[model samples]
Target: MEDCLRIAVAQIPVTTDARANGREIRAAMRAAAGAGARLIQFPEGAASGYPSGAAKAMLAGWAVDWAALREELEEIAALAAELSLWTVVGSSHALTAPNRPHNSLYVISDTGRLVARYDKRLLSFSELADWYAPGAEPLVFEVDGFRFGCALCIEIQFPEIFVEYARLGIDCLLLSSFSRDPMFAIQVQGHAACNAYWIGFAVPAQCGDAASSGLAGPDGRWIAQAPQAATRLLS
Candidate 1:
């Protein structure tokens, strides 16, 4: 296992259009690959836009086209394979009728395989009541000797989750969010320091305007960060 691995944290624009979102994600993957990053972490709902405020009305009505979303995901996986880069993308996971979908992160390996999926377990009030079905399990995956745990927006409020991942022996935590709160960055840094593990915090470009997407080292210091209010990659 390699002792060092280069990972990219992406701050990209996410729209309601799956195709448009896929395009931006693919471009970021190419850039990260060019920068020699082995893995890239994207913001929550990078493929399918995250619903908020007025958008929640559309989500309550179940407006997403599941097929198009799946196609976009597959294309992203193919691109990850081509670049030999591990990719983590946030999207909605469809379930049977009468059941709400899950807010989740899809983990694609460098070999172009869907290795794992981490569904958001601790959802916000609106998410649990209307937008999504809460997930039951936590997820952890490995890359180049580094073990990584996955968490989504709002999960930052729960320190037990971070402690659990630490107990599971993960070296890093990948926390993806659709938040515009600067406190998100502060909370993630605290988690990194408490757990003695690196934290890759990815947020949408819109959110970056409030607090930049960044990578926090074990010492609770930023290793890299994207510029505020910009779509960029932090490697």
Candidate 2:
């Protein structure tokens, strides 16, 4: 197969309202399908834009509502089927079964099946010792003819991980980040410069006080960049 791929990059704003967030994502996925896109990427925590674990706040304990997130993701599954599209989304995973919570990326197939999960590695100081459990293992998921690896948010900073995936002959790299800083350019360029033939998928938390999501080409160029303060679709 050729080493070319068509990806739909979505940069929609997210909120704590699951229903609203779901509705927007469903629409975007449908648009992506209509455009003949095989894969669609969305912002980090696309399901619920709930802020990252805030420190020493009354809401600190409120972030791990596993039951609620499960139901929300189930609906997202159904929506994926409706659109007949594959989706990669960055979101928070509620902790259950005696483990701490995680910032995760969920991969959904066209048939509404949840194919795999990749938890974010390189946890921040906040997450390293508290709030989340560090992710284990590397994920290489296949969609269409594409073999892609998944890494969430800050994990892309670590060059060794992507090198490992490239050594395995991955065709694409899906990176999800929640950064608002200008270093984002460095992140995307670095992801491409090191991997050379690799394309990076970045779906940030969205336009607000923070940065939005976007896509970068193998040449280390921006394919599409969501606005800093507005939600948009980046093809």
Candidate 3:
């Protein structure tokens, strides 16, 4: 078990096109490898693109191609194998008839295997309550002797989740979000300091008003951040 770990925060452009998004993810993974990062984290809905209220309304009648989404995920996992890096990426998970899809984080190991998955437990009443079903369990995974926990988007507003992870003895907390508010950074830093854990926060580059993707130390200081409005990898 290693005491030190290097992770990357990927701030990539997300679009409605899953193919294009997959390509972007692949590019970021290559960049992360060059930077010697063992793991990379992407923003919420990095695979299928996050839908805004208006976009969700428009897509209400459209059919979701789960097969295509799975193919994209497989490609990402393959890239992880090629680069020998772990990845945490956000996407939608399909469920049975009548039930809404889940907003989930897919954890891919360096061996090109789909490892544990973390579904977002907290669904925002204003934004996702109607579209996504809430998940119940917490997700914790170990790498390099460090335990990592997962959360998504607006869930950062709730401190209980972080507290639970702290109690579980996680060394790092991963947050994949689509929020464009400045408060995103503040909340992340606060949580990291309050829990004495590192925080990896990822958000889309093109998200208006969104904070840049980056990693924060347990001291509540930012270790690195991608340039605002640019698709890049920050290690």
User: TM-scores of the models, in the given order?
Assistant: 0.98, 0.87, 0.95
Sorted by lDDT, highest first, which candidate order results? 1, 3, 2
Q: Write down the lDDT of every candidate, Cα atoms only.
A: 0.92, 0.72, 0.87
Q: Number of the top candidate by lDDT?
A: 1
Tell me model 2's lDDT, rounded to 2 decimals: 0.72
Put down candidate 1 lDDT per residue, 1-235, tens digits, no spaces: 9979999999999877788999999999999999999999999999988896455667657677778888999899999999999999999898998999999999999999999999999999988887899998989999988899999989999999999999999998999999988899999889999999999999999889888899999999999988899999988
56: Cα error in model 3, Å? 3.0
Better of 1 and 3 by TM-score: 1
lDDT minimum window of 10 residues, candidate 3: 53-62
lDDT of 3 by residue, 1-235 (tens): 8868999999998866778889999999999999999999999989977675445665664345667778899999998999999999998888897888888999999998998989998888843546777889999999878899999999999999999999999999999998788899989999999999999999987863468888999999998877777877888
Better of 1 and 2 by lDDT: 1
Q: Name the weakest run of 10 consecutive residues (lDDT summed) in model 2.
A: 53-62
Report model 1's TM-score to 2 decimal places.
0.98
For TM-score, the strongest prediction is 1
